[model samples]
Target: MRPFLFLGVRPEDAPADDEYDAMLRCTGLDESTLRRVRLEAAPLGVVDLDAWSGIVVGGGPFCVSDPEDDKSAVQRRVEADLSRLLDAVVPADKPFFGACYGIGTLGRHQGGVVDRAHPEPVGAVTVELTAAGRADPVLGVAPPRFGAFVGHKESLSVLPAHAVLLASSPTAPVQAFRVGRHVYATQFHPELDADGLATRVEAYRFDGYFDPTEAADVVAAARTSGVRTVPPVLRAFVERHLHPRTDSGSGRGVLRDEIGAAQG
Candidate 1:
């Protein structure tokens, strides 16, 4: 089976590793099955879309909505790399999952307006599935309302043309959206659990997610939140698309039995 590609933009080792492990846990993919690529350390090379089952863009401190002058050279380079990758990934309708920073990357690429108008503080919040979301094959597994970790300096202020909105929150109306048939992005972190949030809260205390003085309180809030339903979405996504396409067509049909089994 092809490995899943996890593209991480976080430069800090501690936070990056936490995001990696969190994604692995959520996707139920062993380290061997998921490859981590850090866009901060180096620019992305040619990506053979067929080489991976799916692509996941992890959370990062960089915000696309930031003023150009405020962004460092590294951020600019990473943004360019992601844009180049998306140029390939979107048109092919590749299975891609973007969380937090991903929303900005994919949204911007798809001609959506990303801005700081809808920033969410670091913590857990109840996300409600939209009508389309409840009918989605993968996200349908989620309950009507589920807790998810959200911390972002920007959001999709305007969804891309033709994108399907899957989930939303009062604070962030475009919490989750699908660009093409298979590409998905979320403003919240489905990979994040309580412990992982706690770890991030500490590691990124001074990164402007929240006041450094409130780190402990933020961690406490995250530790006690009920977020059991969120990760299953990730697991379902991986399970649904694990198989490569056959000569016939897209391989989504192969997962019907598994999906029905889960639904049953």
Candidate 2:
């Protein structure tokens, strides 16, 4: 079976590694099954969609709402790479999940209005599922309402015409949405746990998501928030796409047996 690809944009080592680990924990995938690539460190190059079971993108300090002149060379390159990847992913309806920064990337690609109008502070928020969300294959696994960790400089002010709104919060109208059938993007971090969020609070404290002095308070609040239901959405994405049985030849049965043994 092909491994799932995780595209990370955090330039810092600690937070980037932590983000990858958090994703692995949430998705129930080991290092072997979940491969990570730091886009900030290098170019995305050529990505073969068929080489992976699915793709998952993590958040970073970059903001889509930043003025074109304000974007660094790295930011510009990363955006270009993501746009190129989406060109292929959207047309084929490939299995893709993006969180935080992803909403901006996918939204922009789909003609959505992404801006700072809905900037959410670094903390937990109540995410209410839309009627469409409750029926979504991946998001339906989550409860109708749950706590989710969010901290972003921008959000989807207007959803793409072709996208279906899945979840929303009081502060951010477009908490989550789906493009085509398999592509998804969420404003909240589904791969984050309380501890993981705390780490980010410290890492991005001075990055303008919140007051630098409020970093400790943000961490404290995150620790106490009931944000456990979100990770299931990430796990569901993996389960929905990672089909070991789809592999060729004897490896198919062997891989299935390995998975069964691991589960047992």
Candidate 3:
């Protein structure tokens, strides 16, 4: 069986470990089941995309909305790497899913505008699935109005031509989108639950999103905030798509440690 790849770029030692775990826990799949997650450790080289069944990207602190002058060295390098990845993935119309930071990458790759005009604070916001979204087998289990943890300083101001807006919130117009047949991008951190989002609020408090003094308040809101089901979508994606496409004979216990190791 081919393993699904998870790409992340928060510098291995970011202060938001708890938040990362919390967010991923919402994916519902056990770490063992998601056995092929990895980070772009060194160069912005072209990654081998054919080896995996799919790709999942996590959130980061870097801002895609920032101008060229303000973009960090690591951010630029990561963008270049992502560009290469997208060139390969999108052209083939491969299966892909991205959250938060991932949305900006897909939008930029597809020639959409990404900016800070619709930044949402580090709190829970309601997300309503579009008619297409409700009919989608992937999102069928999700409620019509569900809460999500949003702390993005940037979002897709306008969608690319080929993209379909799948979900939205009052604060951000493009909460989620699907490009072509297999690619998907979500503005909110679907990986995060209430507890997981609290870690991010605390870690990212002084950095922005909200007043540094109000970290306590943000934590309170995150704890009580309602959350939606994304893990089921994740499991469905892997089990429904990735599992069936594998070349390997075994499906169940493949690359368990690799999944846990790749996230760090």
Candidate 4:
């Protein structure tokens, strides 16, 4: 079985590691089966999509809606690297799951309007599944309505024409969507539990998701909200894509051959 790749853009080591651990817990994958790539530390060089069962991108402090001039050099590099990688992931319809910042990266790559028009504060929000979401193989694992943690400065204001709306909240209309058969993105953090959200509230206290003075209140609310169903969606994705048949003519097998040949 191939390992699943997790791309993280958090520059801070403490929060980045914590996020990875949280993902491991949520997805039921250990370090051996789940690999981590800190994109802030280095460029995302040639990635073989076939080498992993699937890909999971973690959220970070970077906002895609920020002006190009205001973006740090690292942010620009990370965006460029992701664009290059998505060039392969999207067209091939590879299995992918993105949370929070992941929505920005994937949405922007798919020509969606990612802006600050629907920013949600650092707390739990009730996410309701759409008709399509209720039928989706991965998202269907979640209830039609459940709470999920969210704290972001930007969202998919306009979903791409090719994307199917999945779960939504009252505030964020495009809370979750599927691009193809396997690609998915969510504006909420499915990997976050009460303790995980509280850890991030402290780590990013001054990052402007909310007023620094309100961090404690945000943490308290997160602890009380009881977000449990969202994590199962992530687990379902891992279970579904963890083993791809490598026989000839299969999608994963063809992708493996193409990527392997390109790399060689």
Q: Among these predicted structures, which one has the highest lDDT?
A: 2
In model 2, which regions exceed 4 Å deviation?
Answer: 228-231, 244-264
Query: Using alpha carbons, what is the TM-score of model 4?
Result: 0.90
Better of 3 and 4 by TM-score: 4
Over 97-197, each residue of candidate 3 has an lDDT whose tens digit, in order, gives 88899999999899999998999988888888898666554543455667777888899999998788888999999998887767888898777766666
- Model 3 worst lDDT window (10 residues): 255-264
Residue pairs with colliding backbones in model 2 are none
lDDT tens per residue, model 2, 1-23: 89999999999888999999999
Q: Best to worst by lDDT, what's the order? A: 2, 4, 1, 3
Task: Give each model a TM-score.
Answer: 0.90, 0.90, 0.84, 0.90
Candidates 3 and 4 compared: the better one by lDDT is 4
Give one digit per residue, the lDDT tens place, for model 1 in 1-264: 999999999888988998898888778898999899999999898999999999999988899989999999999999999999999999999999998999899999999999988889988877888888876766666766667889988899899888999999989989999876789998988887778788888788888889899889998877666554263777767877884333232222433333442223
**With candidate 4 superimposed using the best TM-score fit, by how many Å does residue 166's alpha carbon deviate from the native?**
0.6
Q: Name the regions of candidate 4 deviating beyond 4 angstroms.
A: 243-264
| Model 1 accuracy (lDDT, Cα) | 0.83
